[model samples]
Target: MQYSQKVLDHFMHPHNVGKLENPDAEATEGSPACGDQVSIFMKVDENTHKIQDVKFLSYGCASNIATASIITDMAKGKTIEEAKKITWKEAAEELDGLPPVKMHCSVLAVDTLRKAIKDYEIKHGLAEEDKFSTDKIIEELKKVIYPNVGEDIVSLKMVKYVGFKDGTAIVDVEIPKFDKYRDNVAEEIREHLEKFKEIKDIKITM
Candidate 1:
């Protein structure tokens, strides 16, 4: 697929491409099932709760690289609260707009960024212990409707597993072979998970 010039530029020369040793907080997000993963490392000011530095590592397509790079550029030096408000749509716009199918790449980047911040908050005792919950995520996933099945994915026996840690949820789903509805299902699951502010990342596998 032909990517925009901005996308190509960011992908070719991704910014802040390494991890910090003993960072204040860190997080990883993506579909282990799809093998598209990103890990974010951040350094924060303990007193001010501001992001002092940020970086990322990507293991996916050009969209992944570009989105990750742009997010870091937009996040560095921002206060924790400000960074949390950075949306995937803003990341896509910063990239000059990714292709429709590649929109998920932007989501992955934003999710990782927020999760990293939450990781910092949780570890520093700024967030409550029950801030992140695996059961709540499963309940949220149960609300997702599988487009082709017209039933909740949980009811259709599609959810294989659900795991949660440090504000990221890993969900494994099984869809029959050659099922054209796979993308739609993944997108719907993402939309549902996005509603939960504490949920910083979501990975739906099929």
Candidate 2:
């Protein structure tokens, strides 16, 4: 896969790549088992609500490191509200574009940053924790990209159904039997939904 020069530069020498000793907010996302994970730390100015400093630690491929590096750069000096507006597509565009298969790295990076900002908001009583519902599950599904096209499965109309009850969540996705990303989509669904404490078991059908 061909990577843009910017991606290569950030991958080779990532900026703000470290932990903050006394971070006001922090968050970790992704799973090592899936081969990608990121942790974001932030020092915020209470009065200004600005991100005084931001840093990240990434474990994955070049795209992962590059996305994390650029994301922290985008977040630093921005207010928590401004940083919350950062989107994965913008992050990818900032890196001059990432391959379809590697686009999820940008999504993961943005998700971690948003989580960190949420942590700060909750800590400072700026926001309240959201209640978990099937809608939340659907929202998470929107984050699972269809690698073949670099679009979310939800928007692709690949998700046929979603239901949650008791401690189990059931998802029915529409992926061809011969599709190479079938298993990947299922795994992505599991990974995203498993984070909810309300969900004890996941059932995915394709």
Candidate 3:
């Protein structure tokens, strides 16, 4: 596939290429089911809760690698809270929009960052109250009104795993392959996480 100028620039002399000497958080994520993997490292200032540096090493296709690199570039210097709100659509827009099939690569990149942030929060022992921002999402699910699925996502066990790092939200959903509800499930999770300005990233696993 021919990549756009922006994607080419990022893929070819990517910014923030190396690892931090002493990173505040490090995370690895992938799908053996899909043969894609990415690892991200971040340096954070405790006092300001801001990112000092960000870098990633990924074993995947060009789009995935480029997306990961782009995320690091955009996230550096932003407060953890600010960074969490950076959306996949923004990344795609920055890259001049990837192909439909390659869209998953971009999603994976965002998901990787969210996982890394969760790692950071765990290292610092961030409070439980700050994490599990599940109430609003649960409420949103109530409005969906699934026929057989029940009133809320929480009651349906639709949200398999919930976690946070810095302000990023890590959500995992193990939906059955070829299910019609997969996309809807993922979107609800994303919308829920986007509520928090601190949640820069949200990851959905199936």
Candidate 4:
């Protein structure tokens, strides 16, 4: 697939590529099975709720790196509310345009940023601890529609296990690495689970 020059530029020299030391808030969002994952760290002003600094670590293709690079630049200096409004479509437009198949890269980037903000909200006592239990998460998974089959994974018995530890959620699926739908399933799971603020990260095992 051909990528825009803007995409190439950011990927080659991805901005804000590192970890923040004892960051005020941090988040990770992605599916390793899909081959793209991004982690975002932010230093937010508690009084004003503005982002003082932002950084990221990306593990994916050029689109993934570029999306992460641009989104960090957009988030810095913005109020937490302003940062929350940043969308995947806006990130893609900032990079000119991404191929339809690669649009999910921006989704991964945006989701990570939003999750980081949620972490800030939780720490500041603006939000409640996630009330959704492990059983609730599994029930939510049953609602996700697989793109091709028009069926939920639960009905197909694709989901094998669901576990939690230290706020991170682990979902095990029985899908071959070479299957085209493998990453799609993982990404769908991530999207479905994003509303759970207590989930620090998602691990999709194939």
Index of the highest-TM-score prediction: 2
Q: What lDDT tens digits, residue by residue, belong to model 3 across residues 1-206?
A: 56788888888877777677778988776645445777889999999889998988878888877898899888889987788787666777889977655665666677678767777877887633244455544443332322233234555566676666676666666568787766765665565456567667776677
Off by over 4 Å in 3: 127-206
**Best by the lDDT measure:** 2
For model 2, where is the 10-residue window of minimal lDDT?
A: 185-194
- Ten-residue stretch with the least lDDT total in model 1: 142-151
Ranking of candidates on TM-score, top first = 2, 1, 4, 3
In lDDT terms, how accurate is model 2?
0.95
Clashing pairs in 2: none
Writing each residue's lDDT as its tens digit, candidate 4 over 126-184 gives 88655678986897677454544545677778889999889889999887778787777
| Pairs in steric clash, model 4 | none
**TM-score of each prediction:** 0.69, 0.98, 0.62, 0.68
Q: lDDT per residue, candidate 1, 37-155, as tens digits? A: 89999999999888999989999999989999999999998999999999877988998887766776777788889889889988988875445577778766665656553356777
